[model samples]
Target: MIAKFTPVLLFFGIVSCYNVRKHKDAKVPGNANDYLDYVLSLARPIIASSGLDPIFPLPEVTGTFENTILGVHWHGNVALYNGFLFGLSTLTRAGDATLEVVGFRMDFTGDVGLSNVQAGYRCHYDVQGVGDDADINVLIPYVSARFSSSTFLLNTTTTMNSFQILNIGSPQVTFQGFDGLDWVAEAIADIVLDNLGEEILEALESGISDILECIISVTSSDDPNLSIDSCVPVRNVKVIRRN
Candidate 1:
């Protein structure tokens, strides 16, 4: 199970613990809704185009269970560049103390490759698989935490209730690995490939963190509470080109 928690708690912890600039009569540019819209305008694009598809290269893989192994290595890269379309299907309140995010999807086409690998039970594992017309659906639920500025509970992480991944191109991966002892790479790939959902979740978490940080940096604000009226808002979404 992945987590849907956001970095809102980090903002709150920093803001509440320290002295946040209180705009007594801060020329409130707009209401809470407007502020949210403004922030979203900045965040949406960054989230959509954050850390994407370098194929996450792993030169040396290491893990431990009973004994430690070394020199686990790999060659070849997974090409995960994309032609994806992003959208916020729905963002609403769940029950009493949670934020529900649904319809956040990424439609992608990429490749998965692992030409060589050396591990305990597996060696020389290789995959030169292509993934096309694949999509990812995410349902994220966040904890209800208050920040320093507004009553917006949408951006904090006190803890996570859950993070769900509905799909990931439903990629059909084919590969083979052999230790020359008596095992098929397909067997291990099956186990790893079957859990692609976790991979998608991991990517989403990193992307969201980047998006939130981008919003904070561009807005020049510490509190992510939907209360600050950003005069120099990030990028006027009006002129944003999804190219």
Candidate 2:
């Protein structure tokens, strides 16, 4: 419950209770952000990223939550898939959440299963960047704190739909000692990033291509209802490279 808990079952279909916490609102992105759809690619689809939020984890969600639902308690947290530790290919937020995030920290316990330890995945190195004009606007779980469960806690200190939007005081991520096995957790992050680095890059490229195509298509479309001029150029892109 961030604003008003509507039984209308909107925004994650929460049929529970919540108190909408109000904070200093941001410059609510213009519908212009929708133009990011123009940068879409089939190899990497924004819709794919859309399917990621609140499922509970990195590149999907970055928030924290604690509440009782259906008369049962639940807890969950998320972290970004940076080069250091790996849980996902790229850091992406599922673009379909009602509550936005500013910034936050999350803790983990038990087996996070964040990496593919079987392979020798470890910090190899990676670099990625997103352009400023490429403004991307998606509802993402920014701030979160959880142990090991399936509930999202979003933090909204500063929000960014594209990489350029990130700043020194943007969202913060942490995966601490879990089940007293800090070493194990560290190992997993390394491996996941090492093994999946290339894959992640490919996916990102595909996704960007798709967004671009979408914009071009609509711009050239015969439908008067859909026009390129209507698209607000929104791009949240990151470039990750490792040597």
Candidate 3:
């Protein structure tokens, strides 16, 4: 039913795993390349560890679908479980080390049931529908991001640009075992899955924002007088979704 799944779990999955700290062997970055390398080294763990297990499973999700032309409406709950997002790896710098990317792969399963459903035109009808199981998987080969710096008032401010997902693969979203009105169930499922790509991308973008914030913190940690605020603007992350 117009899936509109926000994927709050996906965002926190990466953010919760982050532990920003300078390695014992860490040295001050002398150049742009060095700075990026340093950031990557610090970011590896956060990316690799995100959603390795069913840390967050969405239960009791409610949604609705309505088609005025067909005079059909459905409202119900979807319980998503066994949510696992893994295969986050192969983080590397793009050409000239100016752009960076991290791999992405995720899958989840859920139970769907339209406890209250209604369909009508000239004649009105209502019934309960059950969608037994749903399995969703997505593969975005890589998410690329760029970092830039500008000096103002003798303060070098680092800014991270929006991220782009590359080589986006078709997502696999399927629904099975509907107890009533096969076409209605399919229509409802379709509405939900249509927004999956955008929602997933938003979640990953939030994770990247956290990584950049951590890097800023660790980079300036060595100097007590320096704080992340001085070198990075508030909420330095901004992502623009691209079709």
Candidate 4:
């Protein structure tokens, strides 16, 4: 009788081990975009309650010179070559959610010509945990273009362009105890575009700020009492721009 029961006990032990391992690897479902959408959905109420914009428009990407031109020109002499806008797109991964953004293109057809310019930004988030409290790491990789041109006589044009992929190392963000019921916390992407032109650098900084604000607003809730121990805000937020 004991010998016969031994197999059963061994089988049960093996099954328990497997279950434990599976649970250890368990993660929230869907890709980065889906996760972000879900987070935003939860944050809508809090955002509305805080009297802030509940819905924010995703960044737009354009190639037209007119579209690229903005009042605040970070670099370049030509008005048409001043600024560029890029569209956001979702990139999917099997384990973690990786987002690839493309198309920060600009073009100029005036007396001072700016053409064939392109740029891109990529972001990745590793989301852990269920419901409100989740840990996330954001990585942003970017690239841009370099151009050269000379003035010419009547009906003459000179153009030189080269594409260089800037290696901006991964920026890591770790969120601890991010439950919606508790105090909110967030990590923003700090990108070092020192090698790239100022326009691209400014764009990255603006994007990071937007992301940080949204994350903070979404994670935080109002607890006027200040007595609730769990209601305390998350401590120690570190932002780094890698080159």
What TM-score would you give candidate 1 relative to the actual structure?
A: 0.29
For 117-228, candidate 2 gives per-residue lDDT tens digits of 1112112211122111111111122212111111123311111122121211121223332332343334334444333343333333343323433443443233455543
Per-residue CA lDDT of model 1 for 27-61, tens digit only, reads 21122233334444554444434323222221222
Model 3 lDDT tens row, 20-117: 12221211122334445555555555554553111133211234443433564554444333333333334555534321111221111111111111
Clashes of 4: 4
Whichever of 1 and 3 has more lDDT, that candidate is 3
Error of 1 at 141 (Å): 23
Choose the strongest candidate by lDDT. 3
Residue 91 displacement in candidate 3 (angstroms): 4.0
Off by over 4 Å in 4: 1-33, 37-81, 88-95, 98-198, 219-243
Provide C-alpha RMSD values for all models, in order. 15.9, 20.3, 16.6, 26.6
- Residue 6 accuracy (lDDT) in model 2: 23
What local lDDT score does residue 1 receive in model 1, on the 0 to 100 scale? Answer: 18
Give the C-alpha miss distance for residue 243 in model 1, angstroms: 34
Off by over 4 Å in 3: 1-37, 48-55, 58-61, 64-82, 87-90, 94-131, 139-167, 174-195, 220-243
For candidate 2, the lDDT comes to 0.27
